[model samples]
Target chain A: MRDKTDKLRRIAIEPVTRVEGHGKVTLLLDEEGRVVQARLHIVEFRGFEKFIQGHPYWELPLLVQRLCGICPVSHHLAAAKAIDQIVGVETLSPAALKLRRLLHFGQVLQSHALHFFHLASPDLLFGYDSEISKRNILGVLHKHPQLALQGVKIRKFGQQIIEAISGKRIHGIAAIPGGMNKALAPSVVSTLQTSIREILPWATQALELAKQLCLADRVHFDGFASLPSRYLSLVAPNGALELYDGKLRIRNSDGSSYIDQFDPCAYDQLINEEARDWSYMKFPFLIAEGPEQGWYRVGPLARVNNCDFIPTPKAEQARQEFLALSGDPLVHGTLAYHWARMIEALHCAEAIDLLLQDSELCSDDLQRQGQKSNEGIGVIEAPRGTLFHHYRIDDQDCVETANLIVSTTSNNHAMNESVRLVADAKLSGREITPELLNLVEVAIRAYDPCLSCATHAVGQMPLKIELHDVRQGLLHWLHKDQRGDFVAA
Target chain B: MSGMKSAFSFDGIQIAFTSGQSIMQAVLDGGGYIPHLCYHPQLSVHGSCRLCMVKVGDRYLSACTTEAQNGMQVENQISELRELRLKLLEMLFAEGNHFCPSCELSGNCQLQALAYELGMTHSRFPLQYPTRKRDGSHATVFLDRDRCINCEICVRASRELDGKNVFSLSGRGSDTALQINSEDGRLGSTDLIATDSSARLCPVGALVFKQGNYAERPNERLYDTHIISETGNRRPAVVSGGYPELGE
Candidate 1:
């Protein structure tokens, strides 16, 4: 690969599209036609931490939800849980806990559905190298209309459940510090029960489609960004899959339990964030292993890999099938993220069904009154991964300090590593085609990283890729326009 | 006192009000609409929000402070006044740390409701991100100055209705803020009670009742089901009784 006379160059992919917020991928190359370094940079910053300082602690639940519209419920609940600490409540009321769980289930289901059907399905159903304009949700609509409709219905059902419980679907102000403010009315409970049953079939079909895709494209699924990394997620006391309330669990890359039953409030002791000058997002790693060696994966792939078993029957069956693909506890295939996401969606639907049937869901015991504490930490498994919201309040009950570890920020290292691996393997001294650049995006998308939430910005991203010669500069540039076409810029 | 009532046209609709009533009061009484942050039905009109600006005979004036007069044609819904109000809303958003997602008064906040009414998607101006302080010093009343739009509703209510003068506006222009009326400038040192009219008069999340935070779920808040334009001064009956009990 050596061409000593050739000059080194840099390739840049700016504003990575269809993955929530503004981000770019840069590839550094050596004179010998070898990839030197790959970096994922987050461009936008909303200064949520600096601005949220003076707000009251009780206002956090609703305030943090503004982090991402895609997974507002996660931030909403996570912040609420943190404020619950400030409120000095050890646990929420039974009814409040159940209601919050229902809300979370809806969030997970909708968010996963959105990722698979709206963002990823176009790539999965159509080939990865399909036409740029055709590789989108609208293309899926034109080709597989029924599947598209099912996707819409499933997402709608989840959003409706959220709206039914809270007041509105997005940024619903239901959860508060101690507990939630309102209970699910019996009428809404009945409506959810009826709708969830209908949605279950679509969720099941989604899981089936994901499984089929994984089996059919074994080479792509197995080799594409298949980095063996440690997995971390929240789990129930019994080591079952748990999203809403649980202790932190970590599984080694070789399919062995590393840490179990650690309290999330002490997350600072277990997890540490590494700041890099290249990106605004911080890379979070397990503290014991150090930053370089401790980078771990989160979200669906990690959740499925870390959990001992999924409680619901259908999801459990799907999980078993998914595990059979690797025969290892930790599945390394990045594409398997889609499979795990679908299975979780199935589980979310099943959980919603069960929760809706619980009569206590309609109970009016939504909140508990309590005195405020000066400090508190709240943690939950967001749709993207583990989220931590820590706050220090003054005697006046105002938030004096706030530290938020969002899901995307936690997966920062893994995403960058995947992007590097894909770029090194595919784009070494070659013309950067739209398909090659999209492969890098595919690696990032596998994590379902929400850059907007990571940077706390409020705009959608449009990806642009550029190649530059070391001496001459300005080789070529490709940008995805508003119409989803990769136009040569 | 004159026995006859004074009627005026607002947005092409005729509205009648008692003599000396402001245009905002007349609109509210007649079930008409005008976006306002400082004006309250039972409190003195403090047209500080400037959100209630309306065109009267080609000249723009605040509806909250301007009295309704016979044959006065008010252009509350005109495109120019609407655009001006939207701009004012944007300025209010930029001048303060109004994070709606985290605000307790989000769904019920007059500022938020008015923004939604006017379809304000995002603020055009750069955020000032002023470093405001919170006064959790009160026992039952918490004050988050960050969310305060400087509408002066709490200040007016404290001075006009409560008579305790627990709250007052201090500073100038962008630096203006609601100040607690006590030697130490803390709510805890003041005589303001949880049930004081001033405590409940805040249009934003600035003056929130302690222990009652998140008492109303997001969906059932004041403006969730009905827009402020439609609801006007008639608060939702569900929230009219104050915070709901955990078992209610």
Candidate 2:
């Protein structure tokens, strides 16, 4: 882990394990003992945009859903928004808008639930050093079946609400340009309302347990408690927090530093991605100062920092508690995820209640009665962060191109920097230990990067240890000596 | 487009539907039951049991291809059409090695039910069970060369539904032989994950489910009379099948 030369050298880790999807991380160390160059590699490329070159614009929503299983709704919404732009379907009635917001809320709630329980909870609950076999949700079930069942039910409730609104569970048919495919029937709305009410108690209990477990080991949040970075997110026209569709804004950790609102179509002017050879995930940075200079973050921490207020009372209260815990609007980036999730759940329940009261929900007319072909873009805040899907269509409106900017891409720069800070702060000028390395890896996973959605990449951690003899002035590679017993490397 | 809101408004009208459901299901659930040839109740829908063609809004469409709609009219009571459908079944019988006296499916076969339903007294088409090959690839299931109807149900079900496009018809028209997709023409060749669901949807005895053999016949089956709206719906029904309930 120590740098020997007086020049910056590249260190890369490929196929990062135990995290969602593929990703790679490459660090460039300079003579000053700091990261001179940091590039996150995002490798998976399905050419989804290329494949949609001739697809009808009407099929964009469903086609884009296949882009990422974790946040299909984000893409579905983005495509619809893009089409709404082309078709001149700008204004959504209050009822339609409420329903759209509810759908977005549902997706964020479920996706965050999945990330916490199925993905990150294992490491938190079972102590990262637990045997591989016992480091999964199923393993948790073996130890505490009732808790596992409760988590599963909460996750299912979110999905069921989605299924009730949209015809299918995975690829919801509800979101359409201008409005939705089908309005919620009275029975469906009632069922969802009842389920949400019933699950609220359980959700509260689960949240309490997560907070307790997270704080049980104070060391979990103690690592690399460095100064905060810039945050970015979307804000509603009325100044209330909006995740589905909003104007983009950037703010610093202090909350006093800010930037002007920008249109998403001008994303090229605001953000850019950097590629490194070691990892498949790319580091996306703000484009204010050139592609590589502007360091910014998206997702939970960014959302909290960028927005002035949340719509739901309970969520707003949670935001207050979050700021209390961290003192800064960025709110201790590590714990920002917990705040993001609670806010999403509260917003989801409140939005669902609002949508149910709308008269348009009871209407039988789900479709517009006719199909119109036009390009569309839908942008929404996924659980991980901001998501955008941009589509182009030809005459007769077949899809000409479908480009997507996943939530994880927005946080790429910050995540890489997080890893570098943890490595430098925790292991600088000191001997490297397996415990320290694992902690460094944990710091990166805290952001919950979805590299697969971005570049179809996976992350790999390759630890290189070199022993230097002060008398010798040179270090020897320990890899060859440990080879036969070094497992699979 | 119609303002009809009553549940029974379209009763006895035989409305044509052609989007999602199979023909046999449309006939049985749509209130008019058409005698089927080579169709099974438990397996996936197979149009090879061609006895369910009813005149759609205008053109004749296989009931299986049409998803039922609200008001489009339909009819299957034409005598000439009934006679034509029956005649085809008889032709299929005479051309194959069908011996009811020894056949195990004689009492439950869809072809047999159609014969009784249509009152077929004799087979007019000449008999010709051509010399063909039959290889028993798996230990449990046996393939009978004399029984295949060249219906392409097994082929289509395997390819489209299962995503394993294995089976294909080699020869054209009457000379078609069901070839297991391999250059060597051996069933053992290729990446045929036997667990591939294509064979599970086989209508006739061509690809029998190893577990549900000698199960209930159409007359005693509940799903036969009622449409299976959901795949895993397990409503209590006449348990004439040798196999026990799946979840049990």
Candidate 3:
């Protein structure tokens, strides 16, 4: 086959299935042995922030939870907290605050577990080509039924706790602006305590399996390559780690400079987003510079980096292991996503256990019964990362503008960079193998980008590297023998 | 949100009821099942379901139409209303869809249930199906067109309750078909999303479920009315959660 050097070839991933959000990737490469361009695109944009304007403050929890089906509880509480802040409404009681924290932890635990085992584990575990449809948790079920059941049980436990406390599993109404709608009943508390204790062992086993899997697939850990980027999160005034609600802080990968103590209300001033035409997800960066200059990462990596201390002992242990891997204070290694998730899960269980055990949690008085309506802001660490829901309201307490920045958007720059690096390493290599492509795809999945929450942008394909003269691309070539009519790539 | 605050004062207890439910429905829900002759718990709440009427301020209105206020003084079981309700029941039994013996819903009919409560021996009004057909084209449920009372229970249930808009009235006086609008004509044509209100709206044997026929006779089963009315009252605004708020 001729080198077909002059013309350009385009590879467009339309309606990227298996991923949570609407996203596309364009890989463009020239014939020579050099990289060209890599663009990640998010295609759909339903202006939810604009839509949420003029809603009643009481309805913020319900309204914001609509942001994503995958993580409604996070948005619900984030919006609730925001409303609370805007009105200067502290939680009605400690019990309500405790319950809110417990559920938020559950969100983190379950979401992380789902992302790792179900969505992003295929390529690392079964080598990606093990059948696309069967490459789900069901595939794990066929092989390791007990493990799959354990995963399901763990996720269900998280959901059950939320349902038991919040009134519903998905869009829970318990967490209001001032406080929770209802306090945890004695029977429900007892059930949760027992259930959490029971699930801990299963969670431990799953974590062990995850660790083994990570070690087994070291070569595929090219996605774990360290990148120098800033980490952002919310921390308490005393510099203690706070996930529920706190001041924003951004720290560079090196322990050099931490953007000390900024209010979340000033987020619009700090970070600006540039939307591309191709993808639904928008590219967000520090307002100082555009993508080329203002690339930063958030979520697991950022949270751990920004926080000065881990409150829970188990989480601290995992954090130590995380730091040891890279010998760097900030673990830029994406492969550590598994470790970060497990640590967060353990932290969640521990936090919930502590919260449930609180004497205040059993109080009969839950809501701020006699309190007046007020505007507020709720900032929390969603399972993926930092989440902020800001709401402005009128005198009648109707919400004006509701601006939300999900954790996925925080990691947009890092995700693009990670994909670009992996694409360069794998596709630019001497062989354009299926394993390489799978590895590259898996690398992107490691970030667990919720493109639905993020803005969409165009996918610019990197120039192709023709290692060997080929008749067609791998997908086209593989299907040629099976079907009567096969489209050439 | 302020209309008649002190005008409808009880104690100082505020409650949140589901949207679109009537005050009588709300009171009956909170374990105070009000009794009256015109209130046939099921039949499209005739405000005529007036058997459940209570005092709303100085003006006496049907509780089925008047929404519950936070502190409304409600008079469910008053001494003076018993004779009036008995008289209303006597008038209702005189109307159509009251074939006690041959009726499929005989043991469990709302009219029968109310008739037994009001101690009515016989109807005063004439027996009038008025040449109504047994339009039973629905494969699953049979509709005794003659059994329908034209109370618009099925129509309201189909449109408001189920959000399917499958049932509609065809004629004015006595010629209405419980038309399962097929081909946009009857309900069978449109997709009927089964909801509790839709299932509960059948006052007579006008609409019967395909399955569970004669499964549990009314006498044997507990219609204990209080629990039944609780769920009937709290028809959730966003019942299934995921469906957007009604207007949204």
Candidate maximizing DockQ: 1
Tens digit of per-residue lDDT, candidate 1, span B111-214: 88888888999999999977676788878788778678877767777777778788888998777887888999988999988667777766677777766665
Model 3 DockQ, alpha carbons vs. true complex: 0.02
* Candidate 2, A117-236: lDDT as tens digits: 665666677775565456667777788787777777777877776677665567656665556755667888778777877666666666666656655755555344343777777888
| True-vs-predicted CA distance for residue A357, candidate 2, Å | 4.4
Residue lDDT tens for model 2, B1-248 = 33332121122554443445555554555555555543444445556656667776567766555555655566676786688787888887876666442233433444555565667888888778554555445433334445677766557656655667678778877777788877776555645554554444333344443222322322333434433322212323112123333220
Ordered list by DockQ, greatest first: 1, 3, 2
Q: Residues A1-489, candidate 3, lDDT per residue (tens digit)?
A: 232321222233323343343343445454564334555555446577885554345556666676776678888788777766654666457777777888787777777767666665554567656655455566777777887787777788888877876656776566654667666678888888888887777777776666677667655542454467788888778766677878888887686555778887788778777776655566778787666677677777677767776787767766666666643667766766666676667677777777768777678565554334444556788877888667777643445666677787777767667666766766634445544444445556667635531211111112122222233322111111111122224
* Clashing residue pairs, backbone N/CA/C < 3 A, model 1: A62-B101, A62-B102, A63-B101, A63-B102, A167-B219, A396-B136
**lDDT string, candidate 1, A1-489, tens digits:** 123212221133233333454566656566655555677777566578887776667677777787788899998888888878788788789999998999999999998998888878877888778776677778888999999989988999989988987778898778876887788789888888888878999999999998888778778788888889888899999999999889999988999888999999899999998988766788898889999899898899999989989999999998898898764656998888899999999999999999888998878887776766788888898998988888998887777888899888878888888887887788745467877777877788778646632221111235555554454344555665444556674
Q: What is the lDDT of residue A129 in candidate 1?
A: 83
**TM-score for each predicted model, relative to the true structure:** 0.86, 0.60, 0.62
Model 3 chain A is weakest, by summed lDDT over 10 consecutive residues, at A475-484
Name the lDDT value of residue A472 in candidate 1: 33
Kept native contacts, fraction for each prediction: 0.93, 0.00, 0.00
Q: Write the per-residue lDDT of candidate 3 for residues B105-203, one digit (tens) a residue.
A: 544555556566656677666655344544333434445555565556667766665666667667654454556667745434466643335544465
* Comparison by lDDT, 1 against 3, better one: 1
Ranking by lDDT: 1, 3, 2
